[model samples]
Target: MISGLIMDIMGLHRFAFHSQVGYTWVILAFVHLVFNWGKVKAYWRHRFRLHPHQDLPTPPKQLQQLEHTQKSDRRSLFFSLLAMAGGFILGRLLPTGQTVDFSSQKTDGGMFYHQWSKLGYPQALRAILNWGEQPARYKTYGDARQIELPDPKGYQGLSLESAIATRRSQRDYLNAPLSLVDLSRLLHLACGITHAPGELRAAPSAGALYPLEVYPVVHRVEGLQSGIYHYAIQQHKLELLQPGDFRAAVVTAGLGQNFLGQASVCFVISGIFQRTRWKYHERTYRYVLMEAGHMGQNLYLGATSLGLGACAIGAFLDDALNHLLGLDGQKEAALYLITVGRVETG
Candidate 1:
């Protein structure tokens, strides 16, 4: 029964890859059993020689054929089973994606291996075909009233140097809602419309294509209900995309990371490559990520200046998240998320 569970655990990648390696796991399991059998026989023989006649340690001979095996095999079987149980528990309790690598190179210090993103133009095209959702009818966002602060220029860490020096990602946050003035300043500094008159908001774009969209998940902001609101750059407001913080969905979308659910606010950045891909085709994905990076850095800097806590989260269930935001994830693909709040103090 335990081995059957092990097979299932080992065969996950095989099934996902659609490869014929599932049989290999079975073979490896047997090879492991055989290696242990010899070691168990040696240990048992020594035990008998030492005492002239003594029963082997508990666990019986039913598991891994240990009636005549060496001592090491018995020990190996016990340790292996213990490890398997621990691994099974960890695997079940954690996000199904978590895993531990026991490679010597990793222990000695080496780049941790990561799965390549299944990103391809084909996948994007396939997703786009399913993008049959009605076009978003953007509406005027929250009731925003501009208010004055203690010192407009003096608020954010005095100099740009200090702000940059202290620009660190923060997860701990306060409970205070963002003031309207602070909201205006943060949005204006971070990815707000710039340069061109009545047009051209983002600082840089693939052919000024500006393929990204920012949605704010307002949880405790003042004058704003707990909801997901899209930032309308042109109109200078937050359009209610979907109501409520929806932070719980974000937690799932973020692979159940605890930080996500705890965040006071989060920005969902999506890309509509059609704004650029119409000309670049497959290569447009690269530009979209780069543009999103620019916007993300803007948020980081803006948040640092405002002295509010912020964190840029990249690992997320891309497809699942876009669906939460009512996006088909074809014309619009979720690129990244920036969660913000007050700094938590011990």
Candidate 2:
């Protein structure tokens, strides 16, 4: 999937190739499941039936039984390798003349429009009529300590035009700690609530679903311990989620981008798709990604206005980041990241 996405982003027409690979992968996966069905069933049975206080199952009893188990393991490993080889051969032997015409493809404004067009008229009508009420505006994490952000209205910053004109993807940062005030202002401008009465935010949302959530990984912020923190939009506060410096892990997850470790703080924007999916259905995915882009721009501009350096990052290990932030990949997943810090000036 990641390979397909990279190919698409680079305008490489390899759909036929990817399709063959996908078919081969499915075949191998099916064979694997079939071969391991016995073990799989036993594992699940033990997982469900065993009491919490019960001891783990003992190993094979006799030497003969142990030898038999080792033989089975060897056979499984051999078959797995054979399946991989077969898959490679099958993928290579498949026809590949049918190439996708990237140039001739019609752009229907965006993917959201294309997805909407696929829905039946009756379903579309029902969707519009039954659009569910907005979900909770703020996300809270148990009894985590919250630090209220500074009032955004009182923030002092450069003009929008000035920020835009001078904005750059800054990769170099000074070895200086970011002040709490600067961090608060940056978060407020990026996604914090702008109007409390209407539940509106600094960034616009499709249908006001506002599916995006912000998390800041602190490294060198003054008056704050290094940890992962979630932003609560309703109260405009930061809730501590995990406490520890994770700059090294973050850099590894970001494909060894040393600059990420150097930054004072990194903002990770995640999406909870169900919020918008209730109304837009499949179109919600497109809207969620678009929302991330909007927030990225806001972060860049916000950082620029505050005389700080910022860079938006997209190339990172998805699963690694999801694990680091303690988010389930399906429900709430990391979509984008931005690193911010003071720019070094000689």
- Candidate with the greatest lDDT versus the true structure: 2
The CA-based lDDT of model 1 is what?
0.66
Evaluated against the true structure, the overall lDDT of model 2 is 0.81
For residues 1-346, could you state the per-residue lDDT of candidate 1 as single tens digits?
3444433343334243433566677789889989899887876676444333346454544433434444565678789899888877865674333333434444321222221123443224333323233333232335643222221233544367867878888876666777656666666666666775546664577776677788777777776678777777666666666666587888999999877777677887888767666555445667788888888887787877777778899999988888888788886788999987767532
Provide the overall lDDT of each model, using Cα atoms, as 2-decimal numbers: 0.66, 0.81
RMSD (Cα, Å) of candidate 1?
18.5
Instruction: Tell how far residue 45 is off in model 1, in angstroms.
Output: 86
The ten-residue window of minimal lDDT in model 1 covers: 108-117
